[model samples]
Target: MSLVLAGTVAGLVLGDAWLWVAVEWSPPAYAGFYASGGFDTPTTVALLVAAPVKAALLWLILRAPAPGPLDRRARALRRLLYLAVAHALVLWYPIALLPDVVGAVFQLALWSAIDVLYLLVIRWRSRMLRAAAGVAFAVELAGTADEVLDELDLPELGSSEVAAAVLMLGGAAAIIITLVGQRRDGRWSRGTQAAGWLSVGVYALVIPFGVFFEGIPGGGPVLPVVMGVMALVGTVWLAATARELPVEDRPADPPPARRRVTRVAVAAVAMLPVIALIHPEQTPHLTHTGWSPACYDRPGFGDLKPAERDAAFLCRARSTDGGVPPMFPDGLSDQEVLAYGRVLCRAKDHDEQEAVLTRAGSARAAWGADPWDLVYVCPEIVGAAHPELLRSAAETEAANDAHIAEMNAECRDPWPRTKGVVQATARYFLFADGDHGYLVHDPGDESAEGEMDQAIDELYDDGDALVGAVGSTVLVGHVEDVTDLCLTVKAFRTAPPRRLAGWDQVTEVPVVSRSGRLTVPELDGGDAGAGAPMPNLAIAGKGRYRLRVHVRVGDAGEEHLVVVFPGASRKRLELKS
Candidate 1:
């Protein structure tokens, strides 16, 4: 039993290491999804692997012999491990299958209570603590069968829910049996206690590996083979070492003073890293080379500034009016611009406060009413600013027109012009923001110009002009062109002709349009709820899209359109009266 526990702990630690290796070597391949947006395979795998590893290690250590004086300690450790495993498994399994956020919170709270009870029991043996632990474990077991039964979509019998329930219940039963057996024997060995402590160490080591490797890239395709190999090797190594280990015995009666001190020290050390990990003050470093000056104004932004000031530049600007102007014109040099911009942005100017930023340019461009920038800046503006202009209709038609034009001008064969054009548009949106910019080609291609790049030069000159006008940090030239491109070629729209029960039905509604334009006449029912057919649209542009629904729902509810896209998906817009 002691050897098994030790092996389990060792396996967990090794598994974690293997997981980390997997993440570093092989990332998941997600087709049709943006690289920036996808599931984290490594992290999931790590968490899954860590849980079992921890349980096994704890079980093995408790089975090991304890020094003469602290025989009860072995029993206490065993009980704690058993309770923890049961609580964690019950909560984790149900949450994974059903994924109810509120229910998960409740389960976490229950688990926390169990932990507290376990700690109290170890402090002083009371019938109440033992009862609490038993009740907690029992509740976990009872809930398991029902939760497993409810997961109808699960494939294979005795897998997923059944498998999970068996492991947890079996572990719990084993602990109870072991406790009864130990009481009959009247002797605890030091080997058993060592095995338990070793298990914890193994668990700690395995966690990082599992998180980094197995999960992120996923155990799909050929990765499972790698995982199996790692698990086997880890298990074998641990088993071999655990068998020959020696047990140390302590005095039959140790003063209570020393035991208390040791427990306190262990607890304090364990909490140090956890505290650091969750500290509210810790700020993550930003990896992106290009973040808008506006981001600097965000709280904790100063923590991320590069150490070498010379490597970066800051641009500062401010609008005299509370309203943001279309452009800022200040010809401050690049260095001066970055310094000032940083200050202004940090100030969080509402009206006349100076905006500051750090960048490679002299000043930042204020994004005006351009649809693309509006989508980037205050997305609500797209719907609020222009009532007559249908952004989706105009954008889609423009893209179609652009595609046709490009095909005629470049491809001439009409073979695969759309793909190339679409690719070009994607690239443009990906890298369009900030000072070091590229120009949109005739067919919507973005080519980085060398020292003599005409587009970059033009943008730089135009940006300088705008910065001179507006004092705000972060300025750009020719936002109108970008907005025009997004509206015309990249936006797709679909709307229901009549009220529907759900969004799924809306996808089936044919987007019937005359001259590629949709019109919604004021109809009965509140502006947002069951009324006239809405014009639903999807924008394929690389950046964000904003929808403006036009109508009034009175006090009941306003009509709105749900827009889903790549980043920042699913926004609901109320129809303006």
Candidate 2:
């Protein structure tokens, strides 16, 4: 029964916030063990079985006839044992198990109430303690009922809040009453008597079934109700079983100072283990070297060994000496190599470290191959020169930007404005160079306009113009000829160059005005520049003409340009020299 009580308290503690406290107090080694599934089966069963056994053993010991006076050390050991049992039943078990939030609140209330009742009983030798204890028990019953009502999601105060509030208030009142009763009786030691009786009730009634109740299927509601019924049954049984012993037969109190000292010693010993249990620390000898079972040792880990495991751990350590080694040397498999590569790519490597990256164009490809192996085998190949790399990177960047824009369009959100500016700037440079190249500029600041202008001036020194600011969105074009040709613009914000195709011819007609104006014949045999202000025209072909504006600023506060071509191809535009 005592074991059962301790186990019940333990369960309550486990399910409540006390469990978190226990976790915090647990030694690092224990915590690691707990984390690694050490407590999953055996520990749980031990706790359940041990509580009742300990309680029964204590009951038997306490009932045993008094022995001859013991040695000091023996007495101390006995006291220590008693204290250990009390602390475990009162603190450890309660905090480690039991799921009822309201039950916990009620249990605390009952404890307090019983304390008060015992105080009153000792002070007056009055029958009022039993009544008071009964009343306290009743309050606990009411609180549990309230909790059940709340779980049904009734309109009343949900769950334990109201029950806890009532318990605390009622318990406080009971304590005050008991204190007053004790003072009136001039019995300063009544508190101790009350505690003894309460302990008896806790041992005999609360634990046995408390442990049993928690184990039942659908136990939550049923357990509390059954416990309440049991409390009533137990109260009746105690009343029926009550027997009057002669007053002189009761144990006499020891001297006040000695008794106080004894109680203090007992409490101190009881608290030692609790304190130790509460503030767990790590020991050097029990360090864990492997991954936690909760994480790395889970299901599907078996699928990870050959390729996933190898790729994840091996390739990363591979040497920097270039050229692929046999798929795996030294018993290492391809998957392991890939895994190593993947991990290595993410790790910090020196500048000269030549890393291999396998390009799986899509996610499907990525998942299909051993992902880890792909990490090492994938080559991050870039153009040799800075300009070429920049150009390729810019095209790749532009394509990415366009894809984002497409997604944004479907979502009806404004396209990213910064991307437009970058794309336009990249296009302007790409056209002037007439070949793919890298854009060398300070990455620390977005104000790459100065660097862009320098690149433009150096690349196209004659008869070229930069007519757009970084933040404009519209693009316009003028040209002098008509011909079949392809126009490609590699934007820094796009993933790849955009090839505008199907042009007949192209001609660069010089503008006479500083405002960058030029005129060219229209497709309908009329002057296309006649009634409008002309921009300098680089015409594509004679009859069916297309034009390209190297750079233009738009009204929507973004910058980009339209490279006009009749079809999508990389063929060069024919320039009339």
| Best candidate, lDDT | 2
Q: Report the C-alpha lDDT of model 2 over 406-435, residue by residue, as the tens digit.
A: 432332112233232112111111233233
* TM-score top scorer: 1
Task: Report clashes for each candidate as comma-separated counts.
Answer: 81, 100
Tens digits of per-residue lDDT for model 1, 430-539? 13233332211111212212322433443366432211111101112222323111111122233213223221112111121112222221112221111122232223
lDDT of each: 0.32, 0.34
Q: List where candidate 2 sits over 4 angstroms from the true fold.
A: 1-143, 150-252, 255-261, 277-346, 349-577
Give the Å shift of residue 515 in candidate 1: 29
- Model 2 whole-model lDDT (C-alpha atoms): 0.34
When summed lDDT is taken over every stretch of 10 residues in candidate 1, the lowest stretch is 466-475
